[model samples]
Target: MEQLARLEDLPTRYVADLTQKNLVPLWPSLRNVLPPLKPIPHTQAISWKFKDIKPLLIEAGELTPIEKAERRVLVLANPGHGLENMRATSVIYLGMQLLLPKEWAPAHRHTPNAVRLIVEGEKAYTTVEGEKCPMSHGDLILTPSGLWHEHGHDGDEPVIWLDVLDLPLVYYMEASYVEGGECQPVTNTGTKSRYGKGLVPTQHHIRAKNNYPMLRYPWAEAKQLLNDLAEAQSQGPIQVAYVNPETGEDCQKIIGYSAVMVRANETIQMSPCSAAQVFHVIEGQLELQIGTDTFNLEKADTACAPCFAQVDLINKSSEPCFIFIADEAPIQKKLDLYSVRERN
Candidate 1:
């Protein structure tokens, strides 16, 4: 009976031990340590080339069927986090998608603005408002908020591209929309060869591009100018990146965002302004300093600087970095000054 009592006491001890295990405290919040940054030089930074994507597409072809259907995106930012078969992880939901031959992604549309940077393939087109933009290598197509678009590739090879847009922000607002073209064919039926609709039925050149009116930015020409600038600098430690013309920079007519690039290892101090700005990096890395917070940036990452903060950026890598900065440009006038921030 004494032994049995001792064994029964052991059971109570075990219960007490289990109760003690539940007292673990919650972990502290993890904070991101920001680094010092400066304004990037635009000219030299634009010259930095994004990595070629053809190899990744080719590698996808070599994978097994299961892996082939899987996503093979190599993030321009967060190179470590490869989202295979899962939605991409970016400030925006964008990806460098590679589609195998005969793979047709159905038509869809949403409220958030979207754009596709065509990397390869021909004969496939994305129809927008009765006009089709050929998804050729190096071409950029727009799918503005609420616009319905679909992809149709009839060629013999895979088509790939870098898709960028503000998806997460829209989702956060609980304003997501989706529509398909399965029942209704694209507005462009058989007249697929009419890529040169020229004006897209617009009235004036200013109204054509919509952001100060320019047709076909002609990447070849832009690349040429950047290349020449790089030669002048001898591929120096920094490049002076300029704000994109379409970004509505100092343009009085447009109501959209604007941005420019800064060379890697370069520095820039932003002029103060009341308009808030968001910077998205497409290539290379950067460290930005806004007010007292320092953000170490990687490609495909974005940082927002409130209207009150005096902002500046620096390229931390030896290589060139490309960044797209967006803010509500002043439509009334061009602001040239040292301070763009105003205290409330």
Candidate 2:
């Protein structure tokens, strides 16, 4: 393909007129926005080690109180898009939030959909839409868009969780904002008990009330499922998606979550897709290879890959490796831009 003409090729006076009149030619930048084969994503393959993040989070806790800081969090910003943007990928926002013992994060709701993957400690609970969901290592809790939620810790140790949100996309659309409110009266326990694997409350047939039927996915269940899948299948990566029990759709509308288990000393080559993806290790260790870049991720470590990048995950430990993944597939599919390329 021939190179497109540069803006500098035009006469100075003509360029000046175009700039003065706020009119610009498209030829000079056409190839940029419409690259020949694939999108040029700014998201980079980057990893944040929990060891490096934990101290900063502890310092953040000591520096700012819950009242002053509201929700004290250290963002895991990807440098490819610039650190100021505070995004892990093009659409996902990642943060390590800390809640000290006996602390309470005030109740508020925002337009951006959010989920919490509990990283450490216990007795920490997130109340979403009046349902109190307990936090445990590797558990996933949803605080979807427009739902009031807050955090409270009852344990003796500091509680930490990885917060994944679709804030970048929502903010880019100029639709992100939050409303503060007083503590909510605990109206219900987590809805996870009411539903089982391939089962839902019988009442759902009569009439569905809550937009989000389940607010929490216990890690124990997901882990067991992965083990079962590994035992049932002799080949392929063992994975399970977190979805709405009632509709069997992605749990949230914008971002999708899933758990992947890599057998001991196994390697899995993920299909190249158009949407950026984030991989977080929940247990064991793994080596993540994106294109030519590689990262060794340990428990609680997180990594992000750019769109359409070739990704390979290898279990570095003798024990099985469990991972949590977040991606923009839901929104991409909704926008009709989701695609997977076949390897030659």
Candidate 3:
């Protein structure tokens, strides 16, 4: 019997044959279609999560305006960088968040501990729980898991900060809740200067030794400290460490809470480490490569590199740039830092 048909008839018959045989040819419909992107396999039990936002811009195209207006966000988890979605537990979230001079994202709250490393800003504050915490350039603030916070700008220019949260983990736990502020620019219950100020000596558990009654990290002091430290390490890699204001200890926002220092054109080959690393570039530019993808992160950019991703850094600017980074740090301390030549 002749079952021959024209080309248009071939596809339907092929699908029918596949269905009958419990198999799928897929080639015809998939010839010009894309295969789903696969998440890379981890060697050990641990995994890594890092991204290249530039190539992602090229691949995904510009972010739509509605997206920008809703959350005031300009990027998404792109396939080019292996970010599955906000609900992907093993993934990390990173982006360049631009907040205008008068932009005030009304108060909202959620679970999953988060941190912010200010990229550039002077007169901004994120009132957490109920207290307003003043923000300065390069300051790091913590909004512990499940806390309500709001952002307001009273400064003269646009204020921007990096926002990081444990996305999928929060979703997986079924503990993520987001509620808008009571009203536009809802005022806090108490000001950071009034309640959390260093002047007050009421709460011991929440207060670090350096915990001033003030709810702010001053930039004037931070900038000077970096300048002095860089001058000392001028011939080599520079480091301006951030100790807890209250305890003068490392890893206060959990573990590996500190800012980093990098000079122009300097390249750092991060040693094999176990911490889930996060970075916000406060100044200068950097070239970050994970596997085959590369990222050129500039001021105001942020990244969260999970523990397993082998990492490398290349400085492309002319002056020193400070980088704000937080991570679990090398669990064993043996592979926390390394040289690029060694990685190569």
Candidate 4:
């Protein structure tokens, strides 16, 4: 009876304080800001099929002009999250950008970090700040924040690639900025082709521009690197993380990027990770198991796994399978909130 009476009188005590400065007690709002249970992510395992996306890309290529539309992209919006903003998952945004032959995507720069994984049709090049980075199937291109970049295709067929960006973080920080300009003239003249290799300037230039030095990581180089590493190991998938040539840091400050190649009929088990990840299959077929759900993926297909989700990769084909993977571990690590647990 005493406790009930005190609890009932609490509102009366709060009334005077509320009236003075309009201050409310923190106890009622504690559950929202400091809940006992961690948040349950609404994101679920989802995959995007290439068969359904290709035709739409073709239609868009025919109906839209690259210069006029700026970017002909189809966003892969997750049904479970971000209905209004149309995010791929909770923190990442995935889109398929298309460019027809002889078309050029105007030069532009933005604050959000953008990564591209080539899907189909090549002979296209993404030029960043006067350096041209060629694009091909299975290649991964990194365009760091505030870097002027442009895309153009000179091939006979249309070019398409997956555009992955950290828009959620940009929105959260309210640091979004975009501007367009004419393509910059190429100046670097070395043996690196200005498209496949990074040009080394002075240390002053390096520190002045803190963007990722390696603008383009060709598929041929990655495949050869994986093959060479696989020959030495002879077991398990050969994986490598993309790093900036200057500081040897990750390609993106907030995103950790890696590519893996699984030999035929091989299965690799991954431990539970604290960072949410999404994988895009570049070649062969993949059976991706996240927790209890298993998703079958093929070339150009993308699969997602939330944070703390255990994953398994199985190559269900006769040849090797390649996958481009991205995670938020970089951001989580910055907050000292990253952890991983091995799963049996």
- Candidate with best lDDT: 2
TM-score of every model? 0.46, 0.97, 0.60, 0.85
lDDT of 3: 0.55
* Candidate 2 clash pair list: none
Per-residue lDDT of model 2, residues 128-232, tens digit only? 878999999999999999999999999999999999999999999999999999999998868466676535767547435877887899999999999998999
Cα lDDT tens digits for candidate 4, 232-303: 998866898887766666778888888899899899988787778889998889999998999889889998
| lDDT of candidate 1 at residue 260, scale 0 to 100 | 44
Among all windows of ten consecutive residues in candidate 4, which has the lowest summed lDDT? 189-198
Off-target runs (Cα >4 Å) in candidate 2 are: 201-204
Rate residue 344 of model 4 by lDDT: 54
Evaluate residue 97 in candidate 3 and report its C-alpha lDDT on the 0 to 100 scale: 53
- Model 3, 79: alpha-carbon shift in Å? 2.7
Q: Rank the candidates by TM-score, best first.
A: 2, 4, 3, 1
Which portions of model 1 miss their true places by more than 4 Å?
1-101, 117-125, 134-139, 152-176, 183-221, 224-259, 272-278, 283-285, 290-310, 316-320, 328-339, 342-344
Quote the positional error of residue 69 for candidate 2 in Å: 0.8
Which is better, 2 or 3, measured by lDDT?
Answer: 2
- lDDT scores for all predictions? 0.50, 0.93, 0.55, 0.80
* Global fold similarity of model 4 (TM-score): 0.85
Better of 1 and 3 by TM-score: 3
Candidate order by decreasing lDDT: 2, 4, 3, 1
Error of 3 at 220 (Å): 4.1
lDDT of 1 by residue, 173-231 (tens): 78876765552354544333221322243344333343322222323433445556766
